[model samples]
Target: MCELLGMSANVPTDICFSFTGLIQRGGNTGPHKDGWGITFYEGKGFRTFKDPQPSCDSKIAELVQNYPIKSRAVVSHIRQANRGQVNLENTHPFTRELWGRYWTFAHNGQLTDYQKLNTGHFRPVGETDSELSFCWLLQKLEQRFPEPPQDMEAMFAYVAECCDELRELGVYNMLLSDGEYVMTYCTNHLYWITRKAPFGKATLLDEDVTINFQEETTPNDVVSVVATQPLTGNETWHRMKPGEYNLFHFGERVGGNVDELADVAFAEAKPKSQAPTEPL
Candidate 1:
């Protein structure tokens, strides 16, 4: 399995504090090391950095740790590859163009026998199952809606339906963003923490570092962080159930519910083999 990290904020905010702890898990604190990648969205433009090396040791990851690039939405991943070779193309947090926007996605679970799905609009550049799933998702989205929906409720429902199909294959926790907002789904484990008026110190669970956000953030700032597991030891994170999905915009939760997308039949559809042979 892999780990996912995502962010959505009312104000432009850097992910350094939370990312430092997450990178440590790539090799230092956990064994998810295969490759790691991150994306920072600044308006319509995006800046991304990736490395096949472990995040704990990758100089690129170190640079990300120091860079204060700000964004309203972001998606990142630490890969424990299930399908595909350990190469740049195999990294998670893959990107594609959709509705004239750069849509990014990252997966934290394996999908067995998922290659059966047909991707109509998007195609995979890499051989990873994660990328395959992403391509298929976008393809279906395009087919369902020839253009971006004027109704967000319908769009969110379609996205949830795609996630449900993937969830049937296996553990399918994922994060997706279109540079403005974030959509997250949980098939097993995922938690989220939101920071608002009452800023405080946050201690990393993987790294021995703590940050006092109050010193740097404004009273009106609101930032939300989503991760496979809780990163901070002090924050009160909301835990998502097995079949759950959440939509966040400007750091506030728009709509979410486990019951909205829950389907017990899909859980039973999980492939018998969820574990991989080795990382990548």
Candidate 2:
């Protein structure tokens, strides 16, 4: 299995605080030490940092922790290597170009018969089931809509349906983004928390670090974080149901497969938290 971390913010924000806790799990506080990678979306383009070494010890990981690369949407993963060999190409947070946009994907679980899934034109560069699944998904989307769909909510719903089919094979927790919106699907474990005005202090669960977000954010900032597990013990993270799917844009939960009531509840929820402040 692997661990996933993602962010969608109204303003460009850095994920240093949450990332610091996640990296510690790569070899220190947790056992997902095979490799790790992170992608930060800046405008229409994005950049990624990957390493086959344990994130807790990798210098590259250290740089990402210290450097605040601000992004509107972010996807990151720490792997435990159940399917593929430990290497850079096999790292999580795989990327592909679709509809002239760079789409990033990361998976936290495994599948049994993923190789049977036809990828069509898109193909996997790595041996992991996660990569294969990602390619297959893109192929399907391309087949259905040669160009990007105008109805993004419908497109995201289709993605959730695809994820459901994949879950039939095995566990399929995932985070996917295309610089604008982040889509998440869960078959096992996934949690999320949104923060806005009147920010509060948060302490990391894996490390001895505390941050008072109020001192670092404006009154209008809205930021949402999604992860395989709660990164902070002090915050109240909403746990996604086993078969739930969610969609987020500009730090707000816009749509998903959940009932209308649940969607409304999330949309009208009070503002809650901050990521990091620094130039990209």
Candidate 3:
């Protein structure tokens, strides 16, 4: 298994605070220590960094923590090596060019009998089942739509359909983006939080660090973070149900199988801090 972290913002935003907690899980606070990688989508340009070493000890991870590269859509992953060797090629988040955009993908779960899917034009550069799934997903999309669809919602529905098929094989939680919108699918566990006006302080669950976002963000800024678990101890996070698919663009949720739940919508919801009880 693995863990995923993603960000979608109305304006360019840095994910240092959330990433700090996530990296700790890669080796320090959690067991997913095989490798880690992250991708940042800034306008039409993007940057990616990956390492086969444990994120808790990797100098590359340290540099990522200190660097404040801002972007609208970002995807990250920390792997536990369930289906691939511990190497850079096996690390996520994987990237490919599609529709003249840099599309990134990261998976947090494994699939059984995943080799049955056709790879089409996109081929896996790594031996991981995660990469196989990613290539297959893109192949399916390419076969269905030779060009980016004019109606984005229709495309989202198609992606959800593809995800549903994957879920039939095994756990299929994933995050995908193409500089425009971030699409997330949950087969078992995933959570998200959005920050807007009247920002507040948040303390990291994996470190003794705190940040007052009110001072760091303007009133008009809107930022959203999605992770396998809640990254902050003090913020209210929305838990995605099994079989849920959500899409966020420009920091605001625009499409999904479920209605977009605002930050306040989950204000009174109880925390799902207990280990996941749902079957994978």
Candidate 4:
């Protein structure tokens, strides 16, 4: 299995702290160490990095830790190989051009009997089920809608349905984005947290470093972080229920139901949470 990390925010924010901790999990703290990657959205395009080495030791990961590449949306992954070989092409957050924009995705689950899906316009450069799934997802989206929909809720629902179908094959926990927003679905474990006006100090589970977010953020900042598991000890990370999906925009969950809102409050305390193989 692999691990996933994602972010959606109202303003450009750095992922340094969380990412540094996550990198440790890629080799030092946990088993997901075959490869690692991260993506930062800058308007319609992205700045991405990937390597076929444990994040804890990868030179690229070190650069990521030192670089302050901030973005409104980001996605990252660290892998523990199962279906794919340990190679550059097999790494993730996979990307493809769809609907005239770059779409990125990362997954952390295995898919049994998943070879039946079709990937018309979208194709995989990597030989991984996760990559295949991304291509298939994009293909379906194009078949259903020739252009981006103005009704985002409807669009989200459609995305959920497509994700659900993928789940029928096997575990399909994933994070998806097209620069504007992020769509997260759970097949096993995932968690999320949003930092706002009352930002506070938080420490990483894998590293000794602690960040006092209030000192680095503005009063108007609204940044949300999603991961396979809770990174900090204090925040209440909400777990998305099985067979559930969430849409985030401007650092907050949209289309909130009461139960879902409660879940968000609890997201940081929950189970868990990638972006592509290609270096950029």
lDDT of 2 by residue, 89-123 (tens): 99989999988989999999989988899999898
Model 4, position 257: C-alpha lDDT score: 24
Q: How many residue pairs clash in each candidate?
A: 0, 4, 0, 24
Whose lDDT is greatest here?
2
Off by over 4 Å in 2: 259-280
Choose 1 or 4, whichever is better by TM-score.
4
lDDT of 2: 0.88
Quote the lDDT for 80 in model 3.
95
lDDT by residue for model 4 (229-280), tens: 8777666677777778888886987842226665554422321211111111
Cα-based TM-score, every candidate: 0.91, 0.92, 0.93, 0.92
After superposing candidate 1 on the true structure, give the runs of residues whose Cα lies further than 4 Å from its correct spot. 258-280
| Candidate 3 local lDDT, 124-154, one digit each (tens) | 9889888999899889988899997788778
Q: What order do you get sorting by lDDT, best first?
A: 2, 3, 1, 4
Model 3 accuracy (lDDT, Cα): 0.86
CA-lDDT, candidates in order? 0.83, 0.88, 0.86, 0.82
Per-residue lDDT of model 1, residues 108-129, tens digit only: 9888998898987577888988
TM-score of candidate 4 against the unseen true structure: 0.92
Q: Determine which window of 10 residues in candidate 1 has minimal summed lDDT.
A: 264-273
